[model samples]
Target: MAESCSEAGLAPPPELARLAEGLTDQARLDGVVGLRPGRGGRRAAVLILIEVGLDGPAILFLKRSRQLRHHAGQIAFPGGGVDPTDVDLVAAALREAEEETGLDRSGVTVLGVSPAAHVAVSGFDVSAVVGWWHAPSPVAAVDPREVETVRMIPVAELTEPRNRARVRHPSGYTGPAFRIDDWLIWGLTAHFVDGILELGGWARPWDESRTVEIPERYLTDRRDTSGDVNAH
Candidate 1:
């Protein structure tokens, strides 16, 4: 079961109050990607850390090291598979965030957990643990072997029409994507971003026709003999 810090009188900051409230209902999240619990896949959790930024609310993301065997050089939330020591998904999310991004868990206030979404390529039932970075702290890629860079991207930039588009994979999968300079946010990460924008009323209309093929660099290790790609 998901834990709730709201009962402890820990409310999200004003900037995220609306989004925190919207996430309480599974239906609201379902609109994102029809989220639900996975039946048989391995379990994992990701921390969706939001903080007030100079322009507005921003989300933290990490670029995985290219040297890693899985999801190499991909942008992702700080998280991993649940460890045996983890008390629950929330604990696992916080622990992974701290390990991957040097995040100070003490500064985060858990709002709630979203319905789990299964990634077919990785075979992990991933749950998103939404939290507010009430007390911001300095963070960086702690280990070069696992993480290459840490970034806090403002939601405003993501919602900009020109920054939004659709991405088509070699597997014939097409989905929403966000462009941040050279980085292309797609796959499961982009789906979550799309949902968050809708939940927070931050989404803007963009040309869905503006579709692009997944970059070759990101697809190097993603494709198989059948021409299918992996989700990041």
Candidate 2:
């Protein structure tokens, strides 16, 4: 018999611990968390802070400012490319999160990291680092230079079959997105959402027909966080 998905709780497994530990060691040498492109290319790292609560953990995602170039108003983790001045991948992640959403990093316990993701839009190979933030947020200020808004989706919602779907963008990319109530979490943010769910062993077989429809304005601005919290 196959293992039931619900058997896995909202905590990371030993595999996750091993991966996270390895990243720290590797970062000591290269001092970076990034994806290696096919050949000569640029790679960046993004931090997906998963705030675990009594109800489990909630994944933190953000909406980029509409005025930006590349992937504006698209949902993503609180991160950007690696800075040469940074000490390592973890530093880069914390720095970006501070710059993007001003979420205090002192309380975060990093569980581990998912595999590096390659993005064609920004031509970046990105490493999504997972951490647990234990503090009251509604967070702080978001830097106007990058992010515009921030949202948190409960981890349990990602495993719900009713919340998952393939978001087809006009850019010719049909990819993952989750609807939890009102937020349409697609693009890079969506990918990490699924991966984190799998890591927690909470991946449910969601019905594709039950996809949460994205509001027209979801593609343009910050989420309202009202009404139904759609899942993906």
Q: Candidate 1: minimum summed lDDT over ten consecutive residues — where?
A: 221-230
The residue ranges of model 2 lying beyond 4 angstroms of the native Cα positions read: 1-40, 135-138, 170-172, 209-232
Runs of candidate 1 exceeding 4 Å displacement: 1-8, 35-37, 220-232
Question: Which pairs clash in model 1?
Answer: none
Candidate that would win on lDDT:
1
TM-score of each: 0.89, 0.69
Worst ten in a row by lDDT for model 2: 223-232
Q: Candidate 2: TM-score? A: 0.69
- lDDT for 151 (candidate 2): 78
The TM-score that candidate 1 achieves is 0.89
